[model samples]
Target: MEFDAVLIEPRRAAMIAAGLWLDKTADDYFDACLAAHPDALALSAIHAATGARRDLSWAELDLLADRAALGLRALGVGRGDVVTCQLPNGWEFVASYLGCSRIGAVFNPVMPIFREHELGFMLKHGESKVFLVPKTFRGFDHEAMAEGLKPGLPALRQIVVAGGAGANSFDALLSNPAFDSQRATITRDTRLGPDDVCQLIYTSGTTGEPKGVMHTANTMYANLAPFAERLHMGGEDVILMFSPMAHQTGFMYGLLLPLMLKARFVLMDSWDKALAARIIEGDGVTWTMASTPFLIDLSGAVEDLGTDPASLRIFLCAGTVIPGPVVERAQRVLGARVISAWGMTENGAVTTVLPEDPAQRAAETDGVPLPGIELQIRDREGRPVSGPGIEGGLFVRGCSNFGGYLKRPQWNNVDADGWFDTGDIARMDAAGYIRICGRSKDIIIRGAENIPVVEVEAALFKHPAVQSVAIVGYPDDRLGERACAFVVPKPGQTLSFEAMQAHLKAHNFATQYWPERLELREALPATASGKVQKFALRQLLRDEMGL
Candidate 1:
């Protein structure tokens, strides 16, 4: 947990000298914005199920954060503590994150869809001090689930629910009048700083265990400023973010940068294209940052409804390379330019096309790296690779680089020179633009949500009938990829796809992590050294399924 090991003094001083690390924290900026324009609209939260909306001005939002901070302090929480929040997009999420910042607690936002199978390990691994959740979201009682998990998590001190009754209530903490005296005391002394770890987001790992990505405010701000400047965003632009607040895509660009820009941002609980169209038309939304599916869905909805998206300007797509036809359709129908981007949980937006990049350019490449970031392709021997036709592993190192993985220091993967292997095979053109060809890592990114292939394989291995298993990704037009599981049954045992689903469900595996297609083999194709040849399986999918 000693961040000094990752962010040494020399790199910190260098980044600061290069103007990449702004010494000021988000807490500092939020306080300044509150003082400068207390009544300016800061947040708009929409309820997807009930079609209700809530808007909060600067003063209201800041005061709620202040109260939440004091209430957290009232509990055993203190500086450097971890506060895990697993809530959908709403004011509660915003307040919880800001509250953590105000009191110098590290915010760990988890995906709302994660069930007990995933949450049990994450809560324990994070050493979570205080846990926050909604009483019931999408008809699942998160509070009840957390209560079920409490006994196993010795570090967890409290579970506060948003719509719960009794003493453990999030809204009660926000509305507590007793904490009003310190409404303006965010500037008070605290053991936190811009360089201190502020966010701990978990990302899928190739080794079957989720890695906690640690980041400081300065490290995060380094990417946000350059990305916003490249896209030409400002206060006048309104953003609608339907991606879950937990994902880094929404966490950094959705919540953090919007507060820094002092812009009006709308947070949707779910991805309802109809509701998205309504909000776009009603609120004059000008931009958004999501994955390819969102752009396709929004454009299709806008075209179907005949809504005039004159105010909409940029649709930033990440995680997948969008097709040229999709980009042209979005441009023609939605009246917006698609800005292709690429990033990871280890870092925020690293590469993105410019605001004026044409559809062909956007589709052909993932664009150049953002300022203060460097991307290079190297061969298997770790030497720099050259030219357009040759493919090599992509490595990135820059000011926007993350500190390190939380507990697994060996998993950090940064060389002494600060270069981190991105596990991607890419080709670079003469224009210094890199197009991702393939990934060396075993991860399936289905619709921007990463499914850890090794983790799923590990879980499926527990099945009695499963003698061997390998998870592979097959191309999907809309989601970019879908998972297919290849299994070898035990002697005299026969397995059906339905049986596999039943076993996974009984084991409490996440529904999203389950394989859509299942294939049974007498034995998997392996190397002489007994390593499964996943490329053969992927190729089999390409040839057999005509994917």
Candidate 2:
């Protein structure tokens, strides 16, 4: 794929001039960091369930990465081959990613929760040659699972396990001294450029099957450089990351940024808010980037446990519409600036609230684009909307944007002007800040009227018993489609349809906007990134109604 066709020369030059686009790949920068501070702490991993802790210095991590790279090369995992890793957030994941980069192999990190079906599609689509997995993680035998599917995967040559007895042990790669002699040859053969594909992240299958989003080192760094600068982060800052390394939010900001800034990263493979509070106070964690659920849960935990979060500074929230009350309460309790952000697997963090921005903007809007990124909103007729507060199809163009999806060359869904439709209905304020309403496909059209899902969700979020809420559409004979509310109630609380209707009515919500049906659930179906799967809810409703 020629990135020049999508990203023109002038903008790329401007980005480089503005210091947003570094000319170096991530591996080159990692080597520089190793040379500068070999003894500095590079990563700290915490087992979320057992509370076991491990720390690695830059020197130690570099050695492990070198050995891992050599082991991969010995297994025929050469340049341009996809090295798929399905491991939790730990030192092994870090080693795998850096090792792939070292040998010019594409790092494809699959979520641990993904089973054979999802895993099969991703490995096949990525054409992964060498696959890595934990021997057993979260009670699932990953080694056995991978071995079960190995016969069907002709492209997969090896299955490397992270722990326990397995076909190949990841620890052996670290202890193997034979690779020391092959360093020169390995360096000579592992040549890679800034434009070479470094990461292949699959989108969360919210609406459908995931797409293999391909990103180069330059493209990933374009977002990370400006993000670190905007947050005023430095090596002194310690980052606590709970989002899985497979997700882009965690992959780019959580894993990649630490290497760039030479900062310390604290990884948690699971989400436990109480443990998070303890880690924050004990380790002096200053920053984190995750979805709204983490922010919401952590705020509650801090208040309940009376944890001292004075060391925590910034929280970047994404993946959903954050209710205003949740943001206000979270800031008051967590003692951190709740920064709202919006991005997808196709692009890294494109829009984010700055630390200096007003608090109201953080609660009300999703913030403006970073340098090298541009957004435009268009109507149904492909005409650009002129004024503020008018909702339209959102399109974006930027250097941080992806070049194309893997193996889907014909699916380059971009306009002639190079703007990619975000598949979102959004409105831009006069000051250029964007507020995402919802996905264009998720909107419920009831009798020629569009039900604003964000507004309804926000309003319902204020209800006392409502813990989480999602509004999905159901087929209706008269209205073509009607709104259905899926509610997860607070603990020890139960809600009824009559009570919900009265609550919305008392709050002055219109009848047309009110959900016609209410269904109580323990939890809403969500992607690993915390995005609600409305299509799954719609499917359930259809199945129940026999539509």
Question: 318-402, model 1: which lDDT tens digit per residue?
Answer: 9887998999998898888888888888888888888876678889888899999988789989998756657999899998888
Listed in order, each prediction's TM-score against the native is 0.97, 0.80
Task: Give the per-residue Cα lDDT of candidate 1 at 329.
Answer: 93
Candidate-wise lDDT, in order: 0.86, 0.81
How does model 2 score by TM-score? 0.80
Off by over 4 Å in 2: 1-19, 173-181, 204-208, 441-547
Clash totals for all candidate models = 0, 0
Cα error, residue 124 of model 2, in Å, equals 1.0
Q: Candidate 1: where are CA atoms >4 Å away?
A: 1-5, 182-186
